[model samples]
Target: MRPTDIDDPQYFHRVVDCQWACPAHTPVPEYIRLIAQGRYDDAYMLNWESNVFPGILGRTCDRPCEPACRRSRLPEDKPVAICRLKRVAADYRGDISGRLPQIPAAKNGSKRIALLGAGPASLTVARDLAPLGYHCTLIEKDPRGGGLMRTNIPSFRLPEKVLNEEVDYILRMGLETRFGEEVTSLKAVLDEGFDAVFVGTGAPRGKDLDLPGRREADANIHIG
Candidate 1:
């Protein structure tokens, strides 16, 4: 998307329409304006504050902002490539190894919690829990964390380096992670010193389709 894609259109028009499109309600036109001024670092930071996964979003987001582009219906039938532009901005300056926000010191001593999975939900829960003064220990069976993100998602979609880097940033927030040990049973984890045990182990078992009512001969076919 060109600078004109946002700035040339009246500022009010760009802001009002684009804001409505973003699910996270990120300041779309503001970041685009910053990019137009070559303040790429600020633009990237702004996007990251609202959505931590800027680079991931850049690569995989289903962009709704493009259709909202006022440039549409003009001489060119094409709308501004908002997704590509966001990716460009992020690609240039989304590095946060040394610049990530520091976790605050713990207030009243809180009990420790053990997290049984290191997937997104578990990781996000820990991230939200850590700053609140709850010490969290994340356990994963794989060599590295990121359950489905590391295993199921193809490398072409999410590069290992990018995923690792982002996960590292979150880990730097003072979470303790142990890899290669599966939580075979809840009995041991709770028996240990853990104050609370959270089992985020995901989708271990698929629903059975061989039941009597679910049989193909009995009724309509259902794919689960």
Candidate 2:
């Protein structure tokens, strides 16, 4: 029998149309409450637990939660600014390494997993599994590790410092990263003795626009 996709259990909660409509089902109100009490570190870590990168998503996300924010449904009401509050927590938090989960050494007979790409997906996998004693290796085709964040995204929207710091946090887990490496065959990596391999090449490309009057005439038309 063939398998099919299933919606994430958290998707239902996200559809509840509250101010906390995050991809990871973060408890937006809880963290905001923490921040209100001056528990910046706790708020930051709370976001980190679910969304992983509060600062990055706080900066770059399209703000899915805003549209669903219940406050705005009221007459002459505005949302609680959920996205910006995440940034505030990140901005004022103390050192987070102390709260990070304990990571085991590389030689613990742990499984050696190879991530096929170095985008956010691969990095997040590395982040989650590294602490669980998996020796993660990232294979990226770019000169650096941040993939689209380092390449396509403008640094102004998500600053280089923020991206670099977060990526470095994942790297500090002692995972190996090979830059400018393209893996055409998963068999080759398996043959070389990787116990498992996961590929996360980001979203699919957008369809080309072939309209008659507005196709490729202008040099300033961008299609990201």
Candidate 3:
């Protein structure tokens, strides 16, 4: 057999199955090592770099990485508690205000972008574009951000404080926000004269089963 090409990106992915499986491709082992070393802030920051909402994801993410963990392949062994570990870092880390990206006081060029729905998708776009000097205006129908996250998820699963902290991090980047304003028409939004518009309004309705008792028990039975 020829020599292994360690420099190849695929090689790293193949070696680190958990990281490869993550949607954000977060460096799992590196963060885990940081956690082990008691560098909670470093680990949290690393996770934030890849996954914007580490605290929220730690609590609510389905954890696709767990199934792909190398430890799971071993007999009588369980996968690392990667998701919980993420929460540990989030909970234990000190203030990170000084570490966040510094948004430029002056806008970059003359482009202005409008983001519809203050959900995770729009928040992510605002986070990315704001630092680069693009003026981002986030419009949401709800009184606050985190569209479905705030509306659907319960307080027990995802505490409001944790959600607020993460959302504030992005908002502090100087992105203009218009809450309690719903966009009824795309044409109307397009006429606002923004250079670009991104719609991230999430699915508001759930698919229901057409069972005999589905409608009868609809009051108690809820679709996820």
For model 3, where is the 10-residue window of minimal lDDT? 5-14
Relative to the true structure, candidate 1 reaches a TM of 0.69
lDDT of each: 0.75, 0.82, 0.92
Using all chains and alpha carbons, the TM-scores for the candidates as numbered come to: 0.69, 0.84, 0.90
Across 1-224, the per-residue lDDT of candidate 1 in tens digits comes to: 54545333355454567656777667787898999998777888777766666766777778987788778868868877777777778778745555566566873276888999888668777766776777889999988877787887788988887788666666777888898898887888888888888888876554556776576564555444
Which 10-residue window in model 1 sums to the lowest lDDT?
A: 5-14
The whole-model C-alpha lDDT of candidate 2 against the native structure comes to 0.82
Report per-prediction Cα RMSD to one decimal: 7.4, 6.2, 3.3
147: Cα error in model 2, Å = 1.6
Report clash pairs, candidate 3.
none
Error of 1 at 51 (Å): 2.1
Best candidate per lDDT, number? 3
Tell me, by TM-score, which candidate is best.
3
List the pairs of residues colliding in candidate 2: none
